[model samples]
Every structure is written in structure tokens, then in C-alpha cells.
Target: MGTDMGKKESLLFCLDRFLDPWFGYQLPYQDAIVDLLQVVIVSDNTLSVKEAALQLICDYAWPPFPVLEENFERVEAELRPDVSYAMHMDKEIETDS
Candidate 1:
């Protein structure tokens, strides 16, 4: 599982970097960014990484395009792959360790 942990950590780091506040910056590669986040959301990573990706989508990429909103349910499903959404906790759960 070491490789999984490493991959998870790398994805989280990328998300955290994307979470930073940007001022007056133009996104020439917005599609690429969205694609990366989508991949992370569907990957076998932990809930935290997927949640971070979703957060980035909602916060940074959603308002202008709005199409990303369509996959919110799918991204959320990663939080609780086996259980119902209502049965899950409100806080981010780290299952990689």
C-alpha cells in the first residue's frame, strides 16, 4: 500500500496547491485542471483527496463553467463507496493510512 499512500499524498499536495488563492490570473489550462481533478475524484485514493478535488471544483472551476456540477454526486460517492451518503460523517475521513 505504500505506492497508494504516495499517490494519495501526491494528489493531495496538488489539490492543496490548487486551493491557494489566485488574483487576476487567467486559466489557459482550465480544462486540463478539471480533468486532473476528475481523475483524482475517481481514483482509488482516500476520501480526503477526492473531497479536496471536489472542493476545488466547486470553489474554483464550477461558477464559470457550471458543467462540473453534474459530477458532484459521482465525486461524493467516493466518500462512501460502500455506505449511503446519509450514513457518512460530516467531516473529511482519511482512510489511506
Candidate 2:
């Protein structure tokens, strides 16, 4: 995914390390970030990428947002973040007991 896999990983790690502590664990992946932003960041109570980013950062003040593609300006507040953009997905891993 445009060589930005690391950034996505960082985002997921942030959410997991911070959010999971308070909200419980989840699949740490790009799709998680995208899904979370859609549900938490894109709120009617506020608008704009900056606002969404601010709220998101506030929500999980552990691992910070990394500077990479920084692709928020392209989207309108009316639009939603979709998990469909996450790339290189594999079937759910079955861990050995």
C-alpha cells in the first residue's frame, strides 16, 4: 500500500497500546485505525480533519500520530474513513495453543 505499511502499523500500535488498555484489545492493523476513525473521529459533534485528528490523538494519547503520507487534507468532513483501503490482508491467524 504505497510503501506506507509502517505508518499504518504505527497507527495500529498506537490504538492498541492506548485504546486497548481502556477499551480492551483488538486486531492491530491499518484496518483498525481506518475503522476507528470512521466511528470515533468522524463525529457530528465536530468537523474538519484537524478536529478529527485532534480528537483521535486525544482519545489515545499513547503512541502519537506519525508523519507520513499525511493524507487528511484530501478528504471532506462529509466523507467517511473506510477500512477498505487497508492492503495486504491475510486470513485470520490461528495461533497454536
lDDT of 1 by residue, 1-94 (tens): 2347667657656655555556544567767777676666655667776676666665555333222334445545445442233223222243
Supply candidate 1's per-residue lDDT for 59: 56
After superposition, candidate 1 runs with Cα above 4 Å error:
1-22, 63-97
Overall lDDT per candidate, in order of appearance: 0.54, 0.39
In candidate 2, what are the lDDT values of residues 1-97, reduced to their tens digit? 1235455445545654655446665556644554446443323323443344444444443332222114444434343232111110112122322
Q: For candidate 1, what is the lDDT? A: 0.54
Model 2 stretches astray by more than 4 angstroms: 1-20, 30-47, 68-97
Clashing pairs in 1: none
TM-score of each: 0.49, 0.26
With candidate 1 superimposed using the best TM-score fit, by how many Å does residue 71's alpha carbon deviate from the native? 8.0
Among all windows of ten consecutive residues in candidate 2, which has the lowest summed lDDT? 83-92
